[model samples]
Target chain A: MSRLPPLVPGFVAAGLVVGIIGASLGALFVVGSGADGSILGDPYVRRIVVFTLWQAGLSAVLAVGLAIPVARALARRRFPGRTALLHLFGLPLVLPVIVAVFGIVLVFGGHGWINQALDRLSLGPLGSLYGLQGILLAHVFFNLPLAVRALLLALATVPGESWRLAAQLGMAPAQVFRFVEWPVLRQALPGIATLVFFLCFTSFAAVLTLGGGPAATVLEVAIYQALRLDFDLGRAGSLAIAQLAICGLVAAGLLGLGRSVAVTPELGRATARPDVRRGVGALGDGLAIAIAAALVALPLAALVARGLTGPLSTVLRDPAIWSAAGRSLAVGVSAAALALAVACGLAVATRELRLTYRVRHLATAPDMVAALPLATSVLALGAGLFALLHRVVAVFDVALILVAGINALFVLPYAMRLIAPRMLHVAEAYGPLCASLGISGWNRLRLVEWPSLRAPVGLALALGAALAAGDLGAVALFGTQDTATLPLLLYQRMASYRMEEAAVIALLLMAIAGALFIVLERGIGGREHP
Target chain B: MSTLDLQAVGFRYEDMTMTFTLRVPAGGITALIGPSGAGKTTLLNLIAGFERPVSGRVLIDGVDMAGRAPADRPVTMLFQEHNLFPHLTAADNVGLGIHPGLRLAAPERARVDEALDEIGLAGLGRRLPGQLSGGERQRVALARSLVRRRPILLLDEPFAALGPGLRRDMLALVDRLRRAQGLTVLMVSHDPGDARRIAERTAFVHSGHILAEGPTADVLGPGATPEVADYLGEHV
Candidate 1:
């Protein structure tokens, strides 16, 4: 018997599992909802859709809007520890969303330090931090760094030759920006804006924690409420279908927009650092730096401080915290493995397929798939899955499946980003050779493709695992008292006002997540230098 | 026998209605020379089978290859930017030409080693493309094509980055290899001198039309049209 390639079996197995699960869940929703016509008649459903759009739109705009100046400053200025700072700005990208929400609440909530300080000044008590405003605040806090990182990366893309030409022409700073920097940023903005918009739109945990009521709820929250709170399977199904339709439409639109904006070659040369010599520019740069720093630092500082001064020792000693942490680790590892496996399949398929018009569309599938989960929140997805799976699986088993599903969906984007570029490059560079040698299937992947993808694969797994570890949403929907993950445990602690214990867990989560990312990056990245 | 033949081959971009057509014979360097936007690179892409033409036919040794994908085409392309996989060693890059699917045993590895050795990069197989100099990268790319043993080779200004001396040396090496392998070579070049140095025949492309085609010396001579002259003057 001829031995089949290992990757083929791996791909088939993973694809079948994911496809079956996704399809079965989707089918269940359709079947459970007897109304075949349209799901638009329900006022509750319409409200959820409208609410989702509003919050996502507001959050995306604010995140991207604030990111512009900060990005410009970071791009132009060369301050001390700029490299470290740039890395810090990007840190939140991999930081679990749950952790970020905790950090946000600690600093910005009504009972948070900021509100307490405002009160001390005899300012009338600020309104509750559990509504539209709070959701927007959390979105900004989480995504602002992402916006800055992406935009700064884009701003740094202006060619040094362009800068030199501007200098030779004796162009002013504003003129330099007008001619040199504007074009690059303009090219990059639409894609970045759309990315941030979609991220905010599908946000689960942020909305869950901060949303005050049905009126204030986003689509994802509404889906959770329908399933978990009301046990309304029919309503949940309709909402899921609606969420998919809306998010799918936006994703398609974004993909079209993305195609039109051709990615230009990254200019590798270094430009002259920002000259903060004058009054306004210097002050502007300073303000930008300060604002960027405070946005990230304030919440983190509050979390750390709260951990240190309050019930720190008691939280550490709690056995529930340890158990939850262990469960979180297990779930994270499984999710990462699943995501990596999916990414590998997609990458291989991309390579094996010929670049026809049809294949070009297929190539973008992973992007859309990765972004889909983000558009519909993990909580909503879990709820949808929970309602669907109730027919065949036990609730406890369903929770684990939901956790895995959410993690897989969350990590897909990172995995795609990590693996696709390298995979495409290899295929472009080496495909003809491989093809000519008749290396169509498994052996090609094993001997030729795998070695090249090793670093990217490892990084993808690390990123996927880190993301999964920090996720707090889906678990909340499906979690039993026994199945509690770290994020759930931390939330439990926070809800019970065990500030010290939550803080320690949050810190520990960050360390584990950060350490995993570092280890993978170093492991893969070290090969180049050594 | 001619290893490659393009019989009224044509290509058009997705947004465009216009189709380009060209025909080139095999077994020696045929330079496709033109100004920017004149469809020179497009011609190479079509020949390499990277882009399928809307209406035309390409043949490799009398086999119609119009609908064939790049991988299936008996043609290897050396892009201008030296698209050597950055992470792979020079020898590994060369060995890729042997294709792992061939499950090339020890003997095939020996052939790859021999090709690299022939190109004066005998012991540098362990070094990645990033570590190699531009000229060396070009050599590695050349060695990869040589190892592939494909009858047709497409050079998209592969030697455009080399220094004057290195360019001449590489051109000479390509000439010798083409003769030895009896390879059909189609190359795109902005440099008239490059065309003259390497091509047995040259085709002048302008506005997606092959304005002139014949012996390299005759096509590049003063009798050439003002547009071709202008294109050559600016580049060469």
Candidate 2:
């Protein structure tokens, strides 16, 4: 009789709790109807659904479509600043949405430098930079890097051995994609598309700032107005339910697609020389690099220049700016810690449960957490929590809890997404060995799992922290005259037309977020000698 | 006493409904030679207590160990890829078998040193597994089993990656270890030469069933099934 490995009941219990929480939240959309026609009768609800779907679809298509050519160029060619360019793609993964939006606005807004230059050249100041176009443009800006990363990662997976084989077979560039690259890209497409679509659908800050009017409003924006502006509980509840249904369906589809697709290994080690060497191909490659660089670099450069020329020094002197910066730091640290805890719990749970039904259900928690913050506006969440608990709780106390909760919720998906792959890899490769060694419970985690996951875990933490620090969403709802975050303060300065002050704060925010990410990533990940 | 016994032991993979059964005598090296997809590794996993058989019993020293975990079952497995903990030193990898956690006291270090010396790795205890060559890693794995002193040692193509010279040296070491410790060895190999070199008994398995089992010489000799003969390359 072979001995059965001892099951850790704690991990199982944690899984059960996460499962219950996700199911109950999902059920809330089904059972309750407060104002928007008992979850089924609201015509306004239909519009919200269509708007959300449209924006997400358009954004994902544009981002990924543009990314393909850029990825191919990157994969083939060697250039100065290529490594820096690769790292640039990772910036948006950690960059705060609000900060990125602010950067976009500086370049594209009516009175912004782009329009100013156009006006000087007698181009008549190209039409209004608001509504559907603005939101779609911002979405593309935010997600283009993500799409590039996913596509490049896929392109990298094409083995050099396969490339050598293709060369030996005298395959052309078209033939290479037809056989070698197409299959990998096809395999990676669903995952990349799903991730981008989910990101766009849940987009809160971008929609709120860029959507020109009511006709262009997304579901998350409606949820916010229903709660914060009107204080209408029923309408807010209905919107929440509607948001849940749409996000749930999309998430389920994504999960199903993700399961069917097998993850391919990364392509052979990167080569310094260009893969393509022909006339038209060379021109196309050059154009792709030039466009990708301009698209990412222009706004970033404008923001930095604006900071140098504007009220950076005055903003630095303001105690409010310093306090808000401090608050942002605190929130970021707390959110990162909370996100890590939840991610670890989910990972351990997924490992312990053998039943497919239970595993699939728990797997959705991280996705939900990631997408929910984007789907349901931060203002709406703050309003919902306040309404639910305000009868017994102090407003200020609830405000801080809401801030931390939103930040944690917003960052949870990235942590889970980052950690899940690494954890699964470790489990697939090492679980049997650990089980055979009777290395169960915390001992197994500390000795076997932790060592392998150290790099990914550190990266996840850095990303979560940076996102939290840069977040401008919940701050609008919970931030008081006294408790503003750096982004909130920047917005306040911008609102008062203190353009100089806002510019400085923007630069400082980017610097802090970037610096923190670098320090943490290097400190933890550097421990691995190789 | 017989070191290991299997009573009607059977295993079936969940993905497919095929079943495999096997039994082996104690003390000598029992080689399970088979084509791919023949459930050779499954049989090894079952005996090492890494996987539980769907039905029947496994006994070590006449005691039923059906519910015993791998660590508690007096069995050790050496894998093909050498799953040495990369962070730990070579001696520490061997030391894990005896202490499980490599938490050795003063006297245990001497025992570890002696085990390392016995495996011809005497002074190389402090080097990490990454620093060791392929042959050295396998020797460390062998030393690990020695330190554990487990009656049953399961080898899953542990020598498949080594050069011919090192493979022979390791086989000689395995023979010496079996003689010195009376360890009951069950090894899975595709190479007929490996089976003939070390195993006393060989089992020819195909399609999840043991087609034949007997002394190594007989199994590889005349009148064997054409599949077995082809597998052994009798024409060569």
Candidate 3:
């Protein structure tokens, strides 16, 4: 343990993280070499970058800004269905992007429920839900819930003592918010904003689904156009570099976030919040909560309504849908298993290395393993691997393996985040005893480490499975007629204007994804705390 | 049993630096007493191979422990708490000492049983650590060290979590186990009464230096070093 710095596991973990970055970089180099450097002069590329940044920045700002009031309202008012509402807010993170996109379309599309209602009102069908407006709507739909939950957690962590003191001093709600609640939200803002921005920045399915024409094209869509439509690998490479440069700057900006505020005992949120509701305050909070609920709930409700209105039996009879659903299951399992193993190994190795060495430089490697995927759009990652593999094997021949591998890489960061803290905690608490007892290698892991790791392992597996099952980024790029995943199948159905069949396929996809998450999440033990 | 040696050992954490050079006879109980943040625990970690000293040798029976990992070294330590895995039964936790993977044969199981009985936890071996009291957990930790059979044992404030009576009782148990196992021991205790109870020699550490070392009585007596006298103020 001491002599060699736990090189075997350390290298494996670092290699997993570095290899993905390298593969993406290798793709960049391969493609960029053939680049004519004509991107700046091209109007289409210009519009792509402009729309990409515009939509992403707007989505992040709007999501986080709107989440503040929703979180604050939820924090103060406890109701019958509050916990259920909280859980509902977590749904979008696990839902397939295509399903959510279709849901947005159902609520806001040209012939959707909203437009039909407007038609009856003689409002002339209120414009189409395809372009910047629809793209932003879809982004906000997917991310608002995430931002709300993040802010809500931060709000909950505000020391109850502060609330007590605020009440004692007879502070108004606005004053209380300014003096007390604002700090916690401000501290959490950077991390939450960065996460939402990256998610929207790398968005794939919604961009192509809602965003039509060059004016609405994003960088990811541009890369797809280059690689899949035009067969221009060189242009895709140059666009990837551009995307990578922006991501690098964003990551650098986020470096200061870690040191900002750690959840501390001084926060001391052990006590309950003091009730300070009065007349207007209660009404305002009520209004805020209702609006947020409607904003998040309407699209999902529309999705369900529209999905059930279709010829369900016809969609069920489609063999392609069944084949793709089965394929998605297999790919998700493979991805989750691979991600879990890599994340577990990295957590162990980082903890071990922390013990033997004082250089914390190695610590960030595990986190970076997952972060790389977020920074590089899934389109870039898939194109990189696809280009390199296209040299040896037909791209579709190893589609399942490639999808699983890339999926694992994508989720590795999250798994690392979920599991690494517990691993370090176990090491800190038991490292001395384990070392003194001559416990090392597999024996230590089996006897001392495994007990505390069960919950985190369960979490990692479930998260990986659910996320991979819903993922359409890389799948959309690499999928062919024979190798389509569930999301891709749904997209294909929608492309053919078979809205009824697409809705049915969306329901089935949601069912399978949700079931996979619940079963694996509960399968390991009595309860999972993550 | 083997003698413990810290020859010209120097280590630092952040701005704190500590240097040590001492030898203790085999199979004896030596207590480390110190002021707060005086590197008492860090010294124990160095001895247990949790950390390496900057410029010296950690020799166990004259063999340089240069490249040996904490697990490879011949030592066992009892922490203040977190001594037992909550997920493991008491028997399995103690069994881990005999074999890392708990691949205990019939004879090894007997030995684990014997160790449990010796710690007055014979029937409670089937229970988890969480089911036991504070004193019972410490006993379980001792039982683990007993089964480990390492020539040297280190204790880092192991009894700090227990009440006075329990602490005294556990110190007595350590003395008894030391005599039975012929184990060389260095235990960290902040209370002078604890050093008075079990230790033969007392090492007074302050500001990262061994300010005083002798028989426990002489070190804590009237004519002690001024630093030791000040540390063991009127309270002691």
Error of 1 at A193 (Å): 1.6
Which ranges in model 1 have alpha carbons more than 4 Å from their true place? A5-14, A21-25, A35-39, A116-127, A258-269, A273-277, A355-377, A430-451, A524-530, B1-236
**Model 2, residue A413: displacement in angstroms?**
2.8
Model 3 RMSD in Å is 21.8
User: Which residue runs does candidate 3 get wrong by more than 4 Å?
Assistant: A1-5, A120-124, A259-275, A433-448, B1-236
**What is candidate 1's CA lDDT for residue B140?**
89
C-alpha lDDT of candidate 1 relative to the true structure: 0.71
Q: For candidate 2, write residues B1-236 as lDDT tens digits.
A: 14666676777775643345456677899889988888888777777666677888877777888866555667777778735655568987777666643468988888888999998998999999889999998898888788877778888888889888888899889989988898888888878888888899988878767888889888877867787988877753
lDDT of 1 by residue, A1-530 (tens): 68655347435734654564476457646744654456787676678778888888888888888888887777777678666666667667778777777888888776787888988998876677788998998888877777777676677655543443233223456755655567677777788778777777777777777786788887777777777788777777777767766776777667666532111112223454323246888789779878878878888787677666766677778787788778777788789888777767766566544343336655555555544454455655665566667778797766766787677876775776677678878878887898899986678878887788877777777777778878877787788788888887777776787666777888877777777767765675445411
Model 3 has an lDDT value of: 0.79
- Report the poorest 10 consecutive residues by lDDT, candidate 2 chain A: A259-268
Q: Cα lDDT of all candidates, in order?
A: 0.71, 0.72, 0.79
The full ranking of all candidates by TM-score, starting with the best, is 3, 1, 2
CAPRI level of candidate 3: incorrect
**Alpha carbon deviation, residue B100, candidate 3 (Å):** 62
